[model samples]
Target chain A: MAELLRTHPLEAWAAALAELPDEVRITPEPFVAMVDVRVPAAASEGLAVRGTPLPTAPNTWTPTADGRMVWLGPDEWLLTSTGTVPHLLEEELRDQLRPVGGTAVDVSAQRIGLRISGTRAREVLAKGCSIDLHPRAFPAGRSAQTTLGQAGVVLLSLGEEGFAVLVRSSFAGYLASWLLDAGLEYVPLG
Target chain B: MQLIACPWCGPREEVEFTYGGQAHVPYPDDPAALSDEQWAHYVFFRDNTKGRFAERWNHSAGCRRWFNAVRDTTSYRFQRVYRVDDPKPVTP
Candidate 1:
């Protein structure tokens, strides 16, 4: 059996972090596994394991005991969770959806996570992206994939004006730099 | 500063989407069986209507899904946005 190695992309950022200004804070959340699930709309099965169906609706995610099931399309979804066996989700979901001709693919290494929070969190995000970001419009459990800076990212609401933004590993550095610049005005000087 | 609605993600900024050319054009059943004139019509022609035109828009930055939308070309206002899987809306 081959053992896959996990890497830390935010190592330098974590090392330099000392204190965040009162207005906003950016935290790198590492080690979450992501899986993409797809089923043809005309398939016999509706993407389910046991009785729990993968979310069919758009822009919504359903929390399951295993992970969060995020709807990606009419017949597609992404399962995300934090654990060691994130790869197992691909196998497990494949077994469950296979009989119905659905597909499951592991995309854990393709993405990286960042958490942004504080009083100016929404304001900071609004600087480079446009997703409303208002609490009433996008409450918790709401997730969306949008462009941030020049990279494609998935934004999930963690409620209370906090968000978890997932960007591709290759673009992570650029986005982090972009975000720091966007937040410069909000961070108070010493 | 136009807002485009994605059937699933709701209304988002126009920048979040990529415009796909005219929608609802059916693919020729037998492309090899068509004349040059018919082939040209299939490939190069589009309505480009000033009033209402049905076309495709991708929530490229949002849901990453392709959907069909009907909008007024002059005003750039979407009258309806529907899922790709849904039947195309009847044009008025």
Candidate 2:
């Protein structure tokens, strides 16, 4: 059998990110294990991980030992973690949800993660995003599934002027290019 | 641009939502018993009210949930928004 290798969706954009100025930073997140979960409201307690319960409120996320659990809908959530194998995470999630009549599906490849942070991060996103990026509107831990540069993405607000974007693998390159282009104004002239 | 209030995700931009046509169109209880004309009416015909109208909308780019709203088509102002299962509010 030929050697199997995994590749990042934004591997080609490394140089573009490296060229960004200090005021504007955009970097592809490390490989993350993501799982889509659906559970009944009554049995949501079974979905806890490392003492962190699933966030039941709308458009919110809770930090866990590894990553975080983001509420996607009334009964749906997206569990993300770092440094864990995709299959292993899915298997464990499935086993944990089986008895609760819930479901866990591996969606690690469905999206590629990117972190955009800097003083101008919100401004870079404001170019294409329709949502209000003001600190008062989208504070830390708030997550929204919306469009960015015509590509669908799960956007998470991380602290001041930092954001985590999870976009479909097919649209990853497009979003990266859009981000870089939008951040051009912030890049210092050489 | 309009701001639509999603039942779960609060208010978001209109660009994030997709029109789902007239609301309160329940599925026929007995589809096999309907005449051709009746079936066509059920599937195609809809009220084009000039005033307040109840319509379905899908938050495609947000929560991805379908919800119903009452809006004045002429003014393009949303009166109220409610869940799919909730009863429609009286628009006076």
Candidate 3:
């Protein structure tokens, strides 16, 4: 008898997805997640450790060695990390950039990262999202926040045939189930 | 599938923007002193021109910044995009 790890709705989906048919494979990419932190306006200086200030907006972006951190709004930014969540880096951000009158909320547990890669990646994604994921429209390195099957999602174009989707943890199971059903049309790589 | 050049987010599809009505409407400094007609003008008056018009649009889905643009309403061609603080000069 193996000890079971406590799981949330999304975590359960991730586990169940692993047992998917051999043809339909679900690969869970490691580390990348969305951290929602609220910074107060008074202590808002030095948020962007690098990169130039946005021309018309009050935000900026700092490209990391492997990925980039994009300012989503006032006191909010999406830090793209590789492999594992940078706990020390996040702590540094909280200590260094705590808003004067705002608090930072760690919403990392509320989101899930799903990487859909393979020749049929685009075909699988198009079944849910309406955005033109064509290379001409959404080239590699580009990202957009849009609705996937009417579900809020952050879609990142990782490569010619690779994509990363960030969906709310609550909707992860539904999304994963939808993907598995739609992926049946393609030659599953799992 | 119209392409809109967001002053902050660069060129994106018009679907990413939310039309924010006319631009350059100054708020009344003294609302109590103004007449009813003046108040109505400030609240409802707008220049809905058909030719080249300066309008306000917020990149709601992108950078979420509001900027001004001179676009031809007839042809849907964007001639110039400028920051909100920049003066909207008359174009020939």
Q: What class would a CAPRI assessor give candidate 2's docking?
A: high
What digit string (tens of lDDT, one per residue) describes model 2 on residues B1-92? 87888988888899889999999998999999999999999999999999899999999998888999998999999999999989989877
lDDT at position B40, candidate 3 = 100
Report the Cα lDDT for residue A151, model 2: 98
Most accurate candidate by TM-score: 2
**Poorest stretch of ten by lDDT in candidate 1 chain A:** A44-53
TM-score of chain A of 1: 0.87
Q: Candidate 3 on A39-134: residue-level lDDT in tens?
A: 553344554432322111333344465455555655555665453344644665567455344344445566677877766677778887666788
The per-model DockQ list reads 0.70, 0.85, 0.21
**Which residue runs does candidate 1 get wrong by more than 4 Å?**
A1-4, A16-18, A41-53, B85-92
TM per candidate comes to 0.87, 0.94, 0.65
lDDT of candidate 3 at residue A177, scale 0 to 100: 78
Q: In terms of DockQ, which candidate is stronger, 2 or 3?
A: 2
Badly placed stretches (over 4 Å) of model 3 are: A1-68, A73-76, A80-94, A98-105, A126-141, A147-149, A159-161, A169-178, A187-190
Per-residue C-alpha lDDT of model 2 across residues A29-112, encoded as one tens digit per residue: 876788998889777854575367888888988778888799999889999877567788788888888888888898988988
TM-score of chain A of each: 0.87, 0.92, 0.67
Q: Per-residue lDDT for A47-114 in model 1, tens only? A: 46535666666777777764567777777777776653666867887898887788889998888888
Give each model's whole-structure lDDT: 0.79, 0.87, 0.66
